[model samples]
Target chain A: MAKEKKVHDRVNWHKEFRLAPGYIILSLWVLFTFVLLGWVVGASFSTSKEIFSGAVFKFETGIHLENYAKAWNTSNVSVFFMNSLVYASISCVLLIVICAPAAYVLSRFTFLGNKLIQNGFVAAMGVPATMIVLPLFGLVAGWNILNVSLANRAVLIFLYVGINVPYTTIFLLTFFSNLSRSFEEAAAIDGCPPMKTFWKIMLPMAQPGIITVTIFNFINVWNEYFMSLIFANSDKVKSVAIGLYGMINSMRYTGDYAGMFAAVVIVFLPTFILYVFLSEKIIAGVTGGGVKG
Target chain B: MFDGAALLHLIGIGKGVTRLKKNKTMIVVFVTPAVVMFSIIFLYPIIRTVLMSFFKIEGVTDAMSKWEFSGLANYIKLFSTELFRISMWNIFRIWFFGGIIVMGLALLFAAILTSGIRFKNAFRAIIYMPNVVSAVALATMWLQYVFSPKFGLFKSIGKALHWEWLEKFQWLDPSHLFIALLVAYCFGMVGYHMLIFASGIERIGTEYYEAATLDGANRIQQFRYITLPLLKGVTKTNITMWSISSAGFFLWSQLFSMVVSNTQTITPVVYMYQNIFGAGNSMTERNAGIGAAVGVLLSICVVLIFIVCDKIFKDNDIEF
Candidate 1:
């Protein structure tokens, strides 16, 4: 009845009993998280009065779909949503474009300052944003370009891409190093140049890593608050996070709780949906991409 | 700048004719853009921030020539400012108190998840879900709903349990605000550290546990002797990461106490922001140098923590 090598399949009551406390602890924590997120989702569809009374589930007057509409139009969440979408999409593509080639070259070839550059990047990851933001803000304010909407949008995306470049490049560098050099060897024998070899052969083989990194980058840029708060000053340039923060503050005076909750839902939905689908890859990549590998 | 860089590239390419030259060209063309971006975004600003800390600049945009050289005055003024001192203490409290809660829960959950549990992926994903969402929204939910006085989760629970005193406590009140912030923040952070610990646990070979079990060693003993010792490296990582994130603590504190900076939640970054960037809450005359000095001091704290961690966790030669 027992396959000694396959310990996962066999279940012992004693072991299960011993693990009862752990199961209780994990399930309770997970349940609380669900209740927290679930109650918000419920409140978003309820009237402000119903939410305050804690009858969000009664559906006394049916679901109020107009909360999303009011939030989207009246609260100007649509603009912030679109701005975030554009910034995240553009930043993701630019990160891949800039990081892929550099990762490939750094991993494939050993040259001067390679180790120094790698060490510098690892160090930069630990550098507090405060350390760098002051001067960057100064330099850009000196340029006096933030007042213009188009320039401000471009600057925001550029900064997003710039801050993320080191992480993305180093992540892809590990992925590139894992790939065999035999493909490049075979390509070189066929009169293919190094750059051509990278684009045609190695790049396609690194699709999984690139997709993981792009998803990671997408979530990061979407959820980014501090940089966008500091850089994107105007409503036209504001991201969803800043937009939601503004709405919550104003809602206090306006007393539109339902609409404010809808805005919160809209702000967090994109990354939550992404996480729902790719939790496996995202969780696995969390440690590898987050700290020093 | 682009024209200058393009001209340099042109001049550099004009001299390459051999195989080595072609390979060099490829490497140069590929890595130059990233290095350039990093230099502008991180390198130049870091250098400037450090240098700016030593001089008294009237405005954020003051030219270098206008920066009056005032050695250590900024630091003196910053430490002397009562608000800055309070902000430093607040951040330290967050790091100390919040670190204990996050690390404890993180380790507990990590151990449970890696204990041959079923549906491990589902549990892990659910726990880590908060980090996937916008932190601003998460804080908003806490401030508006979870801690709302009219009808909050805690209040409702307290009422249902018939605990009058618990229900009467105002979580958002100044007396309880810091604890409330720490609780909400720690809840979101545990998932990240748990994932790190889980990965560290997974890396330990199962054979060791098997060997211990054959010798009649129990789970707790095995954990105390083997798991704890082996997880020293990952524990260091957890602490370092927690410190780094704590150093950049602005979003939550700002969200908690906006418009006017509250003493309970004001972190050094928030203080720096209000001082230099002028979030329009000026408690004192703006000294841009003090803001820069705060940045420098925070960075020094991070570096010091890193060095201390390295010393605490020696490079043991015990081969895995």
Candidate 2:
């Protein structure tokens, strides 16, 4: 806040004039983005006939909420949306549970192979999902779990959690390192076990980092497409991304462009909304941890 | 020995020993689950993919007993296939062409934002907005609306400006599809990289700029000499991320090309899918081995870029 106030001094017209080109470029680019997303939102509320006639802005009759209703109900967007919510929520909880202790250990302990484990996680961040998808698919298909619905969702969630484990651990490890070790020392002096000290005291202290990473994990799992496309073959277990792809392809046949845009809006809304609220934190996370890879 | 042991116990070594043992136990318990998950999810699959790339396996889920040892035959065959070659070329073009555009625009935006621009946060947020949205949906917006020949944003703007060429151009035509895909992709990507560059710039203290200004250095000169050089770490980061994402460029390409794989949009991962999981395999034998080889090739590309970047951007512990 202090720094911002310092930067808000009276503007020089000459300086502003000198930056005219830069301002124009950025404004035009941002204007184009608005037009692009604005047009989609407009089309989603307008009828397909009006959309075809470039009257989405005019809205000849009125705003039609049926497009969203049809997309949410008739198109199985509900199933996909619920499945994604479940998958993302469960996967995020599992990531924190599975990664927090591991990251704590990695940060606090001078154990054998600690550096190797950290390096492995970092490198795995760079390992493309394509490189590892085939054998995982083979193993899952061999187990024949994707054929069953409950087991299918379990498989999807497990994959989501597992693929994110490395990142979650690395990100949390950085958080743990920044914390002062004096908390554990005092706890130990007061008869608290090291593990208990971590759970009781240190974990809550690391909430900011945890929340940031969880937001990232949530967005990642929500937008995850390729693996879901490959593994969740049935509509019963499909994520929003894969489900939306199927709907869009079918909408090509149906020619309900408004409904298609509505589905697109529905599919992207959760993450988009999360982003709207937490853009600062999300941006911080991008530059914070596990991003070096 | 008995006397020494008794003396050590009296000195509290026994209690300390137990504490150390307890700590070890805690360490094992805490670290094992993550290691297990990582090994199952990443290690085993990576090893199997590498080994599978060497064998002639008809099915992706084929048993080990059915795998035929084929040396480098799969690699050779992958290079020989025309579609595979085109896919490789397409990805190369994406990485190369898209890299130039994204990095350039990202740097430009980063510079602009840090240059005391108004509404900086809003511009950054809006630019990065598309990235958080699902790629499938983002690509659909471009394909269905932005590239729509009739009432697309580009056509509307063109018509409003009375520009016949822009109004009539088939932006989604085969000849222009690749460029369209690249443009849409770079738009989403620039925001992330720009934030990275902006953060790097912010980390450099204002002291340096002040010092440079006092020494009669102008904004452009100071930026060229100081800002770019100080951003080596962030540039390495940006490049590594861009390459990694490009290597796994499947979702957007898949959305753009759909089921019918085209030369303009097919990437190695898409080709890998076509070889393994694609439907209607009437003529070509289902060689999951080739798919494995493509996976291995992309992994290699990622690692190579990483090593090259590390060498180029050797860290010297610069302090603000």
| Tens digits of lDDT, candidate 2, A1-293 | 88766566434666688788789989999999888888899999999999999899998799999999999999999999999999999999999999999999898777689999999998899898888999999999999767889999999999999999998999999999888666665576689988898899999999999999999899999999888989996998899999999998898789999999999989878998999899988887877664543
How does residue A169 of candidate 2 score in lDDT? 96
* Superposition error at A147 for model 2 (Å): 1.5
TM, chain A, every candidate: 0.95, 0.95
- Error in Å for residue B118 of model 2: 2.2
Interface RMSD of each: 6.5, 5.5
DockQ per candidate: 0.49, 0.53
Candidate 2: residue pairs that collide: none
Looking at every candidate separately, what fraction of the true A–B Cα contacts under 8 Å does it contain?
Answer: 0.67, 0.74
Question: Which candidate has the top score in DockQ?
Answer: 2
Candidate 1 local Cα displacement, residue B3, angstroms: 50
What digit string (tens of lDDT, one per residue) describes model 1 on residues B1-320? 35554554455344333434569989999999999999999999999999999999988888999999999999999999898899999999999999999999999999999998778999999999988899998998888888889888889888999999779889898778898899899999999999988888888889999999999999999988888888878888888999999999999999888533368999999989888776555656776788889999999999999899889877532211
